[model samples]
Target: MTSTPRSPHLPLPAAALLLAVLLTACGNQPAVPDWQANAHGAAERATAADLAGNDRVARQEWARARAEVARTGRPELLARVELMRCAVRLASLEGGDCPAFAPLRQDATAQEQAYADYLGGRLAPEQAALLPAAQRAAATGAVAASAMAEMADPLSRLVAAGAAVQAGRATPAVLALASDTAAAQGWSRPLRAWLRLRAEQARAAGDAPLAAQLERQIAIVETAGQPAR
Candidate 1:
């Protein structure tokens, strides 16, 4: 051969630098869209509108929240949150009295309490205890229904009485009806609130002993229902 063999050229560093540039470019590309963020923002705005006593805005936000929760597969949690949202709207409508809000809050609270009891292993015993009565009532057909209707009449009377009590025009009959309803409902928060109102009415009407008795009943119910704290 006339010439010496040529040395081979190595391009490893150049190839590595090219790969690094490509990777960096890919990493710097635009991010995907964030639907959740937008939905949440809409929810916040809706909440603000609700707080400002705008029912229309509140409803709009509820729809958005529902849609987002459906997409996210968290409908149960979202439903509870929606209850709080509704509660806020109701409070705004009622001039800041939570008790004056719609019954949705009470129903939601009952559900939440039931769930908590289940999680804490406290619901089984209660359910077991109630099963016998439930089964007996179920077997009674129209009789059970009639009894329930009869029971409901008293509750309705109590509700009416509670209204009168709030207006400072309650009588002994009204107080008795309210007390009975409260007891029958197992001192549920809503019922307890009614009982408190009745007690207030009693106090306003110069029946301190009755008011004290109602207060004691309320305390007992509250203590019994309270989660271990």
Candidate 2:
């Protein structure tokens, strides 16, 4: 019986060199952190839940997003998380003192800056007032005109409408923006409620006809979720 010859093996050092080359060729990419992924995913889910009028679910998701981002120890990401946290709080009408967005101001994109500025104007007039008069005026004007509508999320739109009305700048366009938004988001509990509040604001502003019209629209939206007879 003859033994089969085996291929010659590399010496240990040579084998180690080859292994190192192979590993180096593999690129050794870092894995994405679970916390970062979870936070981003939660933030998206929270937005969807909010649009669907699922406040309970959205609230949970927003909290989870903030918590997950906190675990990542990334200050920039934390600022975004805080922005979302404040946005959600404003939605709940518990904005309390305006959130200081200055920490992220330098790093935020233009759109983010606009959103934060708009919210600051509404929730913390004093903070917004610190801006140059022209800039402060522009923020209120933009929100009042609903010029931010194209850039704003639905929740932001609701807040914008309230701010616009409060500023006595709820123009026809602003009213239309709010009316159309509530009509489109009829499923959203908060927006519908906001619409009702807007109707009252309209009445107080001496737009009786508009208030009546909005009240009727609110009635329709309220019945949308009910089981058909």
Candidate 3:
């Protein structure tokens, strides 16, 4: 939102009728789709609005992004877009099946489907081979927090940790790592979200003091990042 360099590591879902995939001229060949340009920041902008807890702006931006991706004429691109949404949600500590990816599954690439399974927490250890390298260890039930740290990109790291959480094999350390990662990135929305989640976990475990500490952390972030009313 503040335009402080949104990382462009991942590719985006394709847009309808807007095949802006750049091409290096090679005789008569078509231009290659610049996957990085197509993805990462665009749809993430939509979800980032949501992460900021702005419901109306989130809805508007999501619709706009979905409309843009609908023109890509590739189902896998759309499916991947949906995956981005689910990953962001997972990192935010929300729980649910990636319902949106189901419809696009019939047309998705095997790799995309495998990723869907990985994110859905239904992937088998053998299927880990099909996943992105950043996520392979997590899919195979490796130490999620450690694996998360191995990722150079902050978002990639969170996505891997989120997949581990979805897989139901995440340790308490996973959430802690997510919080630290968000804080280090100066992502207040996700920092607050992870802190609140940890606070809830502490409350359920009857650790009132720890819960209060976590709440204080959340308050600090929220106060500093207080959005314009």
Candidate 4:
């Protein structure tokens, strides 16, 4: 086969050079670290298992995620992984200090320290600016718990609800919003948790009927996946 002659201005390597330039332009996004990518995916799975209330599975997944992130030997990154786990657990109402991040705290950034405080329900309004975008408004108390219904991401809204609950700011409207978000996401475990709190709130408010209704809802969510008799 007769090959087309190369133009003097465009040598054989010119096509390859052009391809590299075009590829570079198309790949403007920075390359993600392999371990970071793997760790991120594992972290997501861990949070999912947590929301499903599968503690054992969540633990296993979190370990995998931590292992991946630990490859960097970076304490700040490790601390972030710990914080992510703690945040999910907090949202699930499984109260516990982020002990894992403590030793790493010295290496954590100012923003991370602020996040740790926020997760512990101690963040001040001024520190709210350091929190994740999803929780900022809630942290600042600029937005009512009722306004949680307006948050777009289900998981983010749930996390914000946890912050509100920790801060003793979870109102009836907040409970309702959290319950709805959990139910919509089919996160029955969190749904039950939020409903239980709502029931407690109802009883405290002397609304026995409302409390009873919430109790029934909890039961339904609990038995949703059981084998039929």
Candidate 5:
């Protein structure tokens, strides 16, 4: 028989080492979860589609957000939803065809007043003194006039009232009353911001013919004497 050609053979230890290296390489390779990765990719695609003016996709995103809010049952998230809804309504008003959101406006105003009252009662007399004179008078009147007013602190009451005003439930007269009181009591930056935002929202919602109208109203409020409630 012809001499058998010897097959090349590695030492056992070397072979084992090579096998371990191959196994390690395979183990180190990143494993992709195809379903999860695909889902993420699809989400990115959906976002892109939404940005490309796809109303359907945009609505789907909104719906998802709404569902999340519902599932979480967070009041802050609910408030955001309400705000977004209001914004959508305002934006839909093309050529002045938008429906009046009177009820929603009223609700907002109520909420603002409640917040103002709560804040007002919590403030110190010295702090209250920084508020506008008219506002002080209004707060006094609110304190004296309210029969069921269990609100002990003037500043807290004022804050709650301010919150109502900011919510758009309060008329300009009421807002000015609350604002004057807060200002005289030593208006905080937060209170001022609240008033400004309320005025801006009123203008944005087209409550008046133009933003100028809202500005004029605010100016009048800032300068004019307090009205009798």
Candidate 6:
């Protein structure tokens, strides 16, 4: 007599029980990590402060946010926080310390490195003053051009606009882009004020045309939020 072959499948009930066990197990997974939550929370607070015209508080919050993730030992998150800090510093007319980001640069991706280069270039007059003058100028010019063309971050864009003005690369197109951004983003108040001050200084130094152009750009940006007629 031939022996009966055993069925290769589990009974329907057993299959259903297995699935339920899996579903329950997945439902009980761990919550989000503390570092991630803290970092996000800090960033939101910083953004809110920036929008409220509180520059110092915004920068402080941004720095705190970066520190939150720095404790996690995650390079990508750390790089992102560094970039945010750099953006805040740049927008405030203080620029950031280039050397402060050297550690982040080590593990950064190509895009992140580009951002660092741009910030360094933008702050070249102060941060990179020790470099040979010719080398500094070349690097600054190259990074400025690349950043203006490639940067997508809104805060970074504002910073780039201010940098362009400072470097005498303030073409109409550049000014137009900066003006439009400043008008569209209410958080740009501090940046706009800084640009106005820069323009005034230029005027006092006898660059009347440059000053007038910058002032026009500032006027356009400052009036950008007016109610429609």
By TM-score rank, best first, the candidates go 4, 3, 2, 6, 1, 5
What lDDT does each candidate get? 0.42, 0.53, 0.66, 0.71, 0.36, 0.54
* Candidates arranged by lDDT, highest first: 4, 3, 6, 2, 1, 5
Output the number of the TM-score-best candidate: 4
Candidates 4 and 5, the one with greater TM-score:
4
> What value does the lDDT take at residue 132 in candidate 5?
30
Model 2 C-alpha lDDT per residue in residues 3-86, reported as the tens digit of each score: 222212211111221111121111355444577557656776776676566779978987887787667565555555555555
Question: Per-residue lDDT of 1-229 in model 5, one digit per residue for the tens?
Answer: 2222211221111122111111211244554334323323333333333323345774675455445444544443333333332222221111111122232334333332222232224333444443333334434333332421334433334433443333334445544444454445443332344356556766767765545654564554455445855
TM-score of 3: 0.76
Q: Model 1 off-target regions past 4 Å?
A: 1-155, 162-169, 227-229
Residues 46-109 of candidate 1 have per-residue lDDT tens digits of: 6556534456876787677656655645444344444334333322222212221233334333
**How do the residues 11-105 of candidate 6 rate in per-residue lDDT, one tens digit apiece?**
11112211011111124465545665666667767766764566788778777777877787777557656665555555554554456668867
lDDT (Cα, tens digit) per residue for candidate 4, span 1-229? 2223222221111122110111121144655557756675677677778888888988898899889878878887677778777777776676636788899999987777787777777787677777655567677754476566666677667777787778777777777888888899999778988999989989998999999999999988888879878
Best by lDDT: 4
RMSD of each: 24.1, 16.3, 6.5, 12.1, 25.5, 15.8
Off by over 4 Å in 4: 1-31
Q: How accurate is candidate 6 locally (lDDT)?
A: 0.54
Better of 1 and 3 by lDDT: 3
Candidate 2 lDDT (Cα, 0 to 1): 0.53
RMSD (Cα, Å) of model 2: 16.3
Candidate 3 lDDT over 49-70, as tens digits, reads 7566666775676666566667
lDDT, residue 19, model 5: 10
Question: Candidate 3, clashing residue pairs?
Answer: 11-39, 12-39, 15-71, 15-72, 16-71, 16-72, 17-71, 23-31
Q: Between 5 and 6, whose TM-score is larger?
A: 6
Better of 5 and 6 by lDDT: 6
